[model samples]
Target: MTRIVVLGGTGYAGRHIVAEAVSRGHEVVAVSRSVPTDQVIGAEYVQGSALDVAPLAETLTAADAVVSALSPRGDMTDRALEALTNVAELLSGTSTRLGVVGGAGGSLIAPGGPRLFDQGFPEEYKHEAQVGIDSLAMLETTDSGLDWFFVHPAEVFGPWAEGERTGHYRDGGDVLVRDDEGKSYISGADFAVAVVDEIEQGNHHRERFTVGY
Candidate 1:
């Protein structure tokens, strides 16, 4: 089975990914600052901070892939990039692949021109969105040997609208995935499926992809 480590695994997106990976029989480790009151069965939860990567050396060493489900809010408002960079440096030459969960704001509105962030994005979310964009930039300029992939979720994805798992999703490369009605949405469970699918399939190396209905 694949060994996977998920930072911020107790959060909304991370918890879904952990549950999905564990259900698939993958060895999953959920790392966060605090343990979850309701933990996913078949998954190991660890109390850890992304800011300090040294303590996670042993765990990082054995991981097949490390997914950064980290968010840039609260105490991590401006430090998420630092945490991701540290992990990237630690996994630079190793065989472990680095997977990042980015925001929809960095997604392209069309095929070539404007990004969602470049348009009239909410001022409240601009900071966090900028962090996601910066994280992608850091990955692109990293050492050539590092295996990495970034994933951008649809415009409406969060705990507020936790939809059921339909086991289906469409990928929009560099562009936001929207349905015929011009709506971009993906259930958290299906988004997790996309992430784990990429882990098992190894598609889109060193690039970013989007997921939606």
Candidate 2:
């Protein structure tokens, strides 16, 4: 079983990915600033923040893969690029792969259209969205050659939707995913499925992909 480390594993998206990884019989290590009241049965939880880099690097060395499931919030909205750059540097030359839980705002609405962040998105969410966009930009241009993937969710994604685990989702490039109903959504549980599938299958290397119904 692959030993996987998830930074921000107690958060909304991270918990689901942890659950999915454990269900697949992989060794899961979850690191977060605070402990979760409820823990996954087979996962190991570590209480720590990424802001403390030395200890975080120790966890990276022991993992076969690492998923940065962090969102841009509070001070993190400004510091995400630094945090992610550290991750890229830490994983450089190691076999451990990196996967980022990305925001849809950086994704294009069409093949050659403007990104969601540039299309007059809600004002309140702009800062956090810009962080994700910047993180993606940084990863794409970084000189370090690390195996990584930035997986973005659909426009409607969160715990509120909580859709069922169909174990199925359509994958797309930089563009967002949509259906005939013009509703693009994916439950956290199923998003985890896609994440684990990517971790195991190793498809779409060094690029961004999205998952939705």
Model 1 spans with C-alpha error above 4 angstroms: none
Candidate 1 residue pairs that clash: none
Q: Candidate 2: what lDDT?
A: 0.87
Quick one: how many clashes does candidate 2 have?
0
TM-score of each: 0.99, 0.95
Error of 2 at 211 (Å): 1.0
Give, for candidate 2, the lowest lDDT window spanning 10 residues.
Answer: 48-57
Q: Model 2: per-residue lDDT, tens digit, 34-132?
A: 888899999999987666668788888778889999877866767777887888887877888899998889888899868878887999878877888
What TM-score, to 2 decimals, does candidate 1 have? Answer: 0.99
Error of 1 at 131 (Å): 0.5
